[model samples]
Target: MCKFLQHTGLHQCVPSPAGAAEGTPTTHQWMLRASNSVLMLLPAYHNERVFMLAYWILDLGSKKKKKEKKKKKKKKKKKKKKKKKKKKKKKKKKKKKKKKKKKKKKNNNNNNNNNNNNNNNKKEEEEEEEEETLLKIVPTVVCSGG
Candidate 1:
């Protein structure tokens, strides 16, 4: 979750099948050979040490999705807060009636909603597994000569 950003987070980095050529990789080649572990790459580190001496800088793909998610959550919370405030401002007398109706509806729907709850749980588990999966790493080659 806190690891790789969406674009570099293996949106389509499917593993290459067995018997596929294990040819030496080139710069930013779109291939996924068998690897022990996928090292998450950051743009800054790519330009850290080396030839060309920062002439070309890799654009970092971080914080873009994180900030979006955070903003979305904050917006949801604010909406909930506004709804709560409106409910509080309503007449106290109607609150009792609404509460009773809500409780009755909740009880009536709980049994029929069991399957939906289970499906949601399964989806969450699958997402967690995806989050655990690592992105394939490509090693950068460097040489020095004139």
Candidate 2:
């Protein structure tokens, strides 16, 4: 066990497999430690540096898995938000189109009403002029007979 593991109060250590030749200088020995523990085989020619490297590699693999999970969650949330925004935009566009159509209808009705009023005024003026001409002709006939 490394000093880092011993200092952290992890004293438990599992021995190497019995299959290896006992007392053979060339054989490898396995050891276990607590912090992100892994079964590490230390060759007789190698040092503690190799064991520490293996431990760090295993720890980094686990950390990468956790990061991938978090990224997936964030992507799901972003998709939901984008869908909601699109729905709101579509509704707003529909409302705007309806308002524009109503305004156009109102303007058309007002123009029709103004045209009708102008036509009625012209008819009234023509009728009054005919009445005036009839009155003038009747007075001229009466004066000539007298």
Candidate 3:
């Protein structure tokens, strides 16, 4: 559930009593993924009842479908503009980072012998510690209607 919200770029969500926030509500309470996307859920909601039909049968009504279509068009325009701005900023930042990295490489080459020895020793110790952790595990229990 956390991963699904993260994928949509939504960092925070309202807590729902029924576990997942995005799916259909069990009662009068519901938690949405984002503040504004609640419109999508309300249209499909049928007097506190969950959809019993298959995926193709559920409809949000014509009014809601039209409103959602408009909202999507506006969102697409805004998203495209934001993406262009981000791409420009990323290119400039990457160029600056490459220059800084080159300067660091030159300085490191001056003390290459000592730095290489210390780095190798540190890596070996870290790998041994990681291996120990990977070998340990905890059992998990699941209950089904019991």
Query: Each candidate: what lDDT?
Result: 0.51, 0.63, 0.58
Model 2: per-residue lDDT, tens digit, 1-146? 34433343333343434584433221122222323443423333245664666567667768999999999999999999999999999999999999999999999999989989998999999999999998888654444654
Task: Rank the candidate models, highest TM-score first.
Answer: 2, 3, 1
lDDT of 3: 0.58
Task: Compute each candidate's TM-score over C-alphas.
Answer: 0.26, 0.43, 0.30
Give Cα distance to truth, residue 112, candidate 1, Å: 52
Clashing pairs in model 1?
A: none
Model 3 reaches what TM-score against the true structure?
0.30
**Poorest 10 consecutive residues of model 2 by lDDT?**
23-32
Model 3 lDDT per residue over 125-144, tens place: 99999888877854476877
- Residues 70-135 of candidate 1 have per-residue lDDT tens digits of 999999999999999988777686878899999998987996599789889999999878766733
In candidate 3, how many Å is residue 16 off?
35
